[model samples]
Target: MNLELPLAELTALLLASVRAAAWLVVSPPFNSRTIPSALKALLSVAIALPVVPTLVGKVPQLDTAEMVVSLAEQVVLGAALGFLTSLLFSAVQAAGNLIDLFGGFSVAFAFDPLDASGSTGNGVFGRFYNVTAITLLFATGAHQLVLRGFTMSYKALPLDGAMSLHNLQHLLTNGLVEMFMAALQIAGPLIAVLFCADIGLGLLSRVAPALNAFALGFPVKILLTLGGAGLAMTMLPQAVSTVVDKAVTAVMQAIGS
Candidate 1:
């Protein structure tokens, strides 16, 4: 028995795998520490195999210098796309962070062992929202859509060409704005209730100083946040769906599709 592999095809597979691996490192759900690096590497290779045929002809000469450059380009391209997806999806967590801030849960912040970023500042609601969003993302099969968008990105950003930096800049700007806007929309009513609670406490404090209404502010706001959290979460499903579409569009637009 004899086995042989074409150099060009092998090179294409390697380059595609580099891109996929970088993406999985930066993208959410996949980026979680719960997934081992070895598994991610194997998954990257699996993802690359299907696209190898399309890329084989376009694979450049088998020069060491060119190969190094191609690898770097793929890493950068994959990380960019992954970051965009992560940014858009973080809106849900941001909404929860806002709730934590207003509800006095910020003081309960603790280290999250599973977070890739190693940030210790995510409060109770922040962590809760992040977990719920990930659950929804998987349950709704939105992760498949996101993965499909990433795989299709090869069509817009081929292995041989450079991505559009200007387009990436524009998308980054718009993505930030959208993230904040979506977060506020999801958490706005709760925030407003918390704000009004503060105002009422302030008034009571002035009108009846002996009653010490200001002391009740913390507990009252906490109860309001807990109660309104259910209402706010009612919007999360639709918000997640909209965010998936936006993330896919951003990835395509960034690559000039």
Candidate 2:
């Protein structure tokens, strides 16, 4: 028994799946190793289904250099879009890193088993923020926006669209810049408080040599970090809302423009 789809439909599915698979391979939540490849393939198919009809007319014939080039193009396009989707999450992680740095918890970083990258700053503040941010991501329905953006990207950048690898360097540069700016915006207040704590400790050290201000630095800073951490955590739900709004805009602008 031979079950077969029409060649045109099959081609559309494969190409669309390739793009979807490439995106899932790189993008977060889906990028986690705990997600099985079979599930990923199924999700790819599910995603590809809606977009296949739009690509039917544009399906490039699979032959010679043209096919290879087109395959590469699909992969590149998926990766770029995936990177765009991940930018704001990187900012969240960066904010965590900043909190860790200022709180003197940089020394506490350990190999995170849950981290696919194997390296992560598992500082108290950053880890807590990461957990809460992820919780808010699901609770606020931001994941739906992410999936919407994924599907919407194809309309903005078609399967056969031109992609210049040269632009990749610029994308990365801009993403990093945005990451730092967003991190500062999220963690800037707590960081400033920590800075003021440092200054106060320095002044107190000069006032009483035997007071052991340097010895108090760790506990005082930890207290300060914990004290303001709740306020910073509260900002995350709103930040997640803002980030999701901006993320969709970024996705559209990145692909559409």
The backbone clash count of each candidate, in order, is 0, 0
Stretches of candidate 2 above 4 Å error?
1-4, 111-118, 164-173
Assess every candidate by TM-score.
0.94, 0.88
lDDT tens digits, residue span 1-257, model 2: 99876777788788888888998888765776768999998999999998888888878877878778877888878878787767767778778878889998766655455564637546756767766777788777787887788888677777777655556566667777877888899999999999999999999999997999999999999998888877888788887777777667666666755
On lDDT, the candidate that comes out on top is 1
Instruction: Put down candidate 1 lDDT per residue, 1-257, tens digits, no spaces.
Output: 88786888889999999999999999987988889999999989998899998888778778989889999999999999999999999999999999999989876754445554546578888888989888899999999999889998777777897888888888999999999999999999999999989899999999999988977887888789999998888888999999999999998788777
Write out the backbone clash pairs for model 1. Answer: none
- Give per-residue lDDT, candidate 2, residue 133: 74
- Which runs of model 1 end up more than 4 angstroms from their true locations? 1-3, 110-118
